[model samples]
Target chain A: MSRRTALAGAVAITALLLQVTVIDRLHLPAGRPDLALVCVVAFALVGGPTYGAVLGFGVGFLADIMPPADHTIGLLALAYAVVGYLAGLVEDVEERSVVTTVLMVGLASAVAVVVFAMIGALLGNAHISLSAVAHSLAATVIYDVVLAPFVVPLVSGAVRHAEPAG
Target chain B: MRDSRRARLVLALLLLTAFTLITLDFRSGGGGPFRTVGNTVFGPIERAVTAVTRPIGSFFASLGHLNSYKSDNAKLRAQNRKLLEELRTSDANRAHLLSLERLDHLAGQAQFRIVAARVVAIGNALDFEWTATIDAGSNDGVRRNQTVINGDGLVGKTLAVGPTTSTIRLGADPEFTAGARLAGTQESGFVDGGGHNPMTFTMLNTRAPLNVGDRLVTAGDTDNHDRPFVPEVPIGRITRVLPTPGQLYRKAVVAPFVDFTSIDIVGVVVAAPRTVPRDSLLPPSPSPTPTPGPGGTGGTGGTGQQSPPPSPGTTSGRRSTSPSPSRTP
Candidate 1:
């Protein structure tokens, strides 16, 4: 259990750092992938909803409060946690279809983006525009869908391997 | 039901924690414990990552285009030597002109004291426009509202000063504004940021004549009490003008000389030059051997030389925005 927690924390921290420093500068056609969000969703899919929520909150809070982050802290934490918890609830489903996985990630990413936008609006962040948010939401869903296949399996496999078996 | 009930309780608890953090962070305006801890823990790691990856990245990048780099290096070497000779001639001419301008007490030629800094990071993960982080901070004489500029023109103003770093809000940011005047003309106006579009400079008077391709520069009138920006720094060129019928003023789009996207190094105006007040009528008291002080040399030489980065932890003297009457330049 302790080893698993450490692995999760390390993955979360690495993803957060890369998201800000490396990923932000990539300047792809659509946008940068939300590696931090994807990391949380991956862990939750493997470790269950409770673990997902915990990881999302910790990682999101750190990312939000980091320097150069002008938004209100904890806004992403709530959004990511909700997304993670919901994604985790899908672990019990027997149908492990590709379409199901894509739909699940799509829904989770959309929820995260909209929640983040709504919270930003409520907090009176003038930079948030409904049209811009919708645009970003579309781009984010596409990017997350493409990234989910790699990030989810890698993180889940790593975490499960780190866990001590009976 | 029991398992679902536990999951619901967990979700509720996490939500409550998140909201509490938001309230605390909002009230403290980023001075809260969360931000402090986050910065303390992550700042060093970021510095390390940047330090390690930049050199490696550049090496591979250079290798990828070796033949092109070789060709460019040969061409640039000849050009560089020619430019160096021209620079020497210009430097001599500039010194003579500066002396005349000082003797005449030209407000537009006022010298300045500046601290040089390197841009360490660009936009955030969300791709927020017109903001960046620089290596210099309050520790290096950087303070909130100090104007930042590059070799080409004005970039932005320092937004917030951290202990070891500072955030700059670029000219393209929606919140940025500055007073501008047409080059070689007395027509003055205010320029407002237009985000993705070029900034709009509005002439205060409707009758003011504006022509396309006219240069714009900062209206750094100390007498008017403009905060932080040194007078007469280059801004940009007028690309297009909009004249509205019966409107009180005319607006033109200014294409800033500084390319906001590729900014690598910037200078912060730590102190304004000692200027003779514009209203003073007495003939400038001529001191024997008028040696231009540090402020004059540093400010005027900004475009001539790329200063070696300041040693870490070295800080310049802090000066108030109020123009000092010292005989230093």
Candidate 2:
């Protein structure tokens, strides 16, 4: 991998690591802010879904590992891969603005929640309630959107010279 | 169009994947083979994340250390001030423990073994269910039905065990109901979990006078074994007791002694195993807990008591009858 791409990959993993281990612990409103979602959306909006999807898998794989309990290793990997794929869709358009990135974060956060729930369901973790899933989705969308305006510009502006892998 | 089709196909597959995982996990799918695969794929990534985030972890750890240090300093001064009080309480606890240990010695029970586990995963995705995953599993001798304890009190038991990790349903999981006895009065009841926070402890029979602040402990009797299932494990102090004077039984709410909200370390007790030598004819198998853990009893019966709750929607244990002057057998 090119040095810039490799650095971006490391940064993405760091962001996700901070997420499950620390950011997840923040838990305002009994819900956690999806920092990885914001990061993934930012990258994907600038890089396109294909790049986003691939990055998503990388980040998700790391996230799955850092949980308080990481029994099912790749559960997050699958979930994140999907989220990255969705974020990749944002890259089709030419003009990438901060607003667009924030919007992508909100949307991607929703998708992440849904995918996470769906995967948990498949794994037979019986206690998940439909309502909590919905609320988490709503909460993440709002959190990501709120964070997007600040994070997107910082990431996109800083990474302008750093091109994403296709 | 082709790109869109490919993208749509990927999205569709992801949705399918999410759906499949949700269904399988909810059902608990009997065997946790798939989870092992999930762990394998994600293990490297998790390691990388940890290595990459060590600095961040160190920062947080230092902050936590400072807070705890301050709390400890205050506690030590209080301890000095209450030296006399400490002696009194210490004498009382010593007396209590002396009496209890006598009983244990008489019974020839093994000394308690505590194994520390790392917090690997927290919270079940897709639902409001409150649970966590620990790195210790069948390989760690963590078995199905093993009792898990934290600093505060009993958290829950092991449900699923993989080679390297296991799944534990916190006491607050909606489907969990445990057989518990209020410490002070010996009034036994069934503790049930409803939501994510405080859980409810209900006496099957009516007329047990329960109050806020009443402490709860394990009943220590298993129906099948007639042996003390698990040793004296604390549950929590009663936070609220529902008043139902006219009803057959009364229910009380308890704030768990172990703070499920901020759990970092846990110990799983390898309780009385299931593989109790069904017959002498067969060769001895390793473990008996439904899901085997690393360092688990490995089918060794009579090692320790398990505080494991019922699987899914099932719970076992009959309610104690209305307060009798004497203990019911």
Query: What would the per-residue lDDT of candidate 2 be over residues B1-329, giving only the tens digit for each residue?
Result: 01466666765665466445544543554344555554554433443454354333432332222223222223323432343343344454344233222322312222334344545555534235456666565655666666766545577877656555566777877767778786534567878776544688887656445666666776655564312235456677778878877787788888776667666556565544333221111112233213222233222445445523224223222224446567688
lDDT (Cα atoms) of all candidates against the true structure: 0.65, 0.57
Q: Lowest-scoring 10 consecutive residues by lDDT in candidate 1 chain B? A: B61-70
lDDT of 1 by residue, B151-184 (tens): 5667888765676666677787655688887654
Residue range A1-166, candidate 1, lDDT tens digits: 6787798889888887776566654546645578888888777766667777877788788878665565678988998889878877876565556677777787888888888878778877655666557666877788888988888778767876787471
| Per-model TM values vs. the true structure | 0.69, 0.61
The candidate 2 chain B region of ten consecutive residues with least summed lDDT is B276-285
Off by over 4 Å in 1: A164-166, B1-3, B30-33, B56-110, B175-214, B219-228, B240-254, B274-329
**What's chain A's TM-score in each predicted model?**
0.92, 0.85
Which candidate tops lDDT?
1
TM-score (chain B only), all candidates: 0.59, 0.56
